[model samples]
Target: MTRRTTLNLPQLRAFLAVVDAGGFSAAAAELGMSQSAVSHAVASLERELAAPLLIRAHPVRTTVLGERVLPHARMALSAVRSVEQLAAEATGTMTGTVRLAATPTVCQGLVPGLLRHWREDQPLVTVRVFEGDSSEVSAWLEDGTADAAVLIDPPPATAGSYPHPGVQLATDGYRALLPRDHPLAEEPAIDLRDLEDDPFLISPNGCEARVRTIHRLAGLRFSPTHRVRDLATLISMVQAGIGVTVLSEVSRSLIPADLVLLPLKPDTSRRLVLTGPQNRLWHPALRTLADSAAGHLAHTASCTAGPAVGQPLPSRSG
Candidate 1:
């Protein structure tokens, strides 16, 4: 007779919680377990796997092995949940996890409300949001770390394809964000030339494509005085009078009370795209989420100033 060892579901659960929460302490709080117990579970798992899983960096970086194992673990968990669902089919309950990634701006301005709505509608489904810049979000989807992503100016499908394929969640035009007292704030609308010499705050290098397009269309070089990664940070800097920045109508919700959003001349626009693996069918809960996001954005656009100051841009619908 051959000896066999059973899999430790509790230990695996603890490890996944730590990865999702970004640290042992947070994982413990989320799982309602003692921090020491969480740590011990992870230690036991590491001993079993014979590999160090996570790096002790702030924000809890995952090691290469951890990254490789993460997707498999998620899949295994999903399978287990599916079995439970089969057993509970007569009860007509839905439960699973959906992982989504997006730019910090979208995460802050649009996703929170959508997630809240999702929780109300699908009480059993867990939604996890990951925030990063455009490139990082795209990479997350490609690598299976995220099930889907919301992206602006998705890299051209080819070198020059406009409005790349996949599903479009929404469309928004650009605007100039200015401090309330700035000279250009009183202008009913703004021309690109008016911003030529203005000190500008802009998205970091990874998000330069659309910004570059605007600059190119305006026939000016984008010489931003400050480049930041998060839209909220850029808006805060603008509110503090550091510099004016260009923003999308969708970003209007993030504008501070002291800032004003003026429409840009020539009507430059961007598309928000929801992307995932081409062939995989989305879970019903995720489909509900995407539909809700699209509906909310449509409702917001039709009823509001489109990009009024102090309001976040809607994430879906034109």
Candidate 2:
């Protein structure tokens, strides 16, 4: 079988230093080690290199193969040390900009408050935010465009192979938005069949695809006549009587005064997960920000206090 790993540079260098100084005792004196210690280093190096590094019979002669590998081993050792030096400088100091990608709903609703909460602890770490859909957020994480990300778990049909298994921070549910004067707007919850023939306005941004999927899975028909990309625009279309739409609790704060938000019957929901590069360690500030959002923001993103998904609309008075 082939030796599966490249040579360990430090061990190879120790073996070379022993070879240069002739005998193990003399090499130890020159390299600042005990003779037995120098001998053990060479033994370990030979095992990994899969080649005899020294002939132990006399004044430590390099084996024929060891002489052939000396130059390459020295260069590899030099390159490894250089990388170690640079990494030592960057590993823990959390002072630079950290980039993150998020969906528009998170970008507008959750991110601002998360920044404020994180800033008190990480005053020096400047966070830059970018907006995208769930797929874009996960892609940014895989490609190194983002240091971390906040995204909805993609709908099963559209999910991609993400680098890291996400840490779910929250679950947001869907709601139906209607103009305050819509005939059935005061209902506690909306049955999909109630609006089976009503004109639908699909929210192209946020979790629009999710709403569509829920309708499909429920075996209901949702023929949207108008499509829009902004939450405010999605609401405006409903307000102007263009059509009705479905939104999630994350977007509840953006709803207008004239709109009635009630839970979507047989409620559909999605988990919000935090994603980032799998192998890299997060800087101190970045980890703190991620932790804060995961620990605190998850609970607060829902519109629990209002007459939205969790409660019934007020009764209309004469």
Return the clash pairs for model 1, or none. Answer: 250-313, 252-311, 253-311, 253-312
Score residue 59 of candidate 1 by CA lDDT: 85
* Tens digits of per-residue lDDT for model 1, 1-318: 954445587887788889878899998987779999999998887887778988977788789998887877766665565466455555766666677898866776667776887787678878888888877887777655576788775653432221223445556678888999998889999998888878888877334677778888888887889888766688788888888878877777777778898999857877777654433334434554555555655666678865522222333332
The estimated TM-scores of all candidates read: 0.73, 0.59
RMSD of 2: 17.9
The worst-scoring run of ten residues by lDDT in candidate 2 lies at 309-318
True-structure lDDT of candidate 2: 0.67
| Top of the candidates by lDDT | 1
- Stretches of candidate 2 off by over 4 Å are 1-93, 154-167, 279-284, 295-318
What is residue 36's positional error in candidate 2, in angstroms? Answer: 58
- After the best TM-score superposition of candidate 1, give how far the Cα of residue 101 lies from its true spot, in angstroms: 2.9
Q: Mind sharing the TM-score for model 2?
A: 0.59
- Backbone clash total for model 2 is 0
The TM-score between candidate 1 and the true structure equals 0.73
Worst 10 residues of 1 by lDDT: 308-317
